[model samples]
Target: MKIFDLAAGADGPEPAVATCSRKACRSEASWQLLWNNPKIHTPERRKIWLACGEHRAWLEDYLQTRGLWKETLALVPDTSSAPIGQDF
Candidate 1:
């Protein structure tokens, strides 16, 4: 299990590939863990932690213990959005 820095995001360049939030796992993320630390963030604010199939349960358990887990959802790629381009 890798110690991942969630804020750092996937280890890559533009058009970033979403990877598991697990420290060192490079597997593509399959689930989105949406949560918020009520003590630090606003109620409406949500922080996302991506998880691959293998780490989903572990991550969820971690967050749930802290009472931060709000919801988990399948990570569906957004096809409607246009890819990043040089020309704006």
Candidate 2:
């Protein structure tokens, strides 16, 4: 099976996956923010943050203060259904 298929089938719940937009960061992300970037995404679309655990709290706080917390929370994927990997 293809990677996507395997990923889909071998999972309990789907975790949110996103890529960091930072120039120097290339980490695979599970947390993201729906930020709208006129330079890239359309005005109606929000961008993502793809934050690691270390940055999750910080990022959430920043977004919360901006009144974008609801939007940000909406992007969080449900982990309860995701499969636990051996790495954990």
Candidate 3:
């Protein structure tokens, strides 16, 4: 399921911020870790994990150990008018 921080004053549900993928981490994410399991996912399918500065290396190492890591890049907020949940 998708998890999003609630915008306190908004009438409809809205995303307040993008958070780290690490469990129980509430810090805002600054990096995007791209990965996928070769055994389960196609080569072109990329899965994303958001990571805060403090956890980037840890998350990368975890993925790398499993031979799942593809790349790491700075997180850039999307400005397009695409549907919220379509990409995943």
Can you write out model 2's per-residue Cα lDDT over 1-88, one digit (the tens) per residue?
Answer: 6676766676533554454434455555565655553555556765556565556667668767765543544334445645422110
lDDT, candidates in the order shown:
0.79, 0.53, 0.79
State how far residue 52 of model 3 sits from its true place (Å): 0.3
How many Å off is the CA of 44 in candidate 2?
A: 3.2
- Residue 73 CA error for candidate 2 (Å)? 6.8
Backbone N/Cα/C clashes per model? 4, 5, 0
| 2 versus 3: better TM-score goes to | 3
lDDT of 1 by residue, 1-88 (tens): 2453455467622455668888888898888999999999899988889899999999999999999999999988755534422110
Query: 37, model 2: CA deviation in Å?
Result: 7.8
Instruction: Give model 3's TM-score versus the native structure.
Output: 0.74
RMSD of each: 11.2, 8.4, 5.9
**Higher-TM-score candidate among 1 and 3?**
3
Query: What lDDT does model 3 reach?
Result: 0.79
Q: Give the clashing pairs for model 3.
A: none
Sliding window of 10 residues with minimal summed lDDT for model 3: 1-10
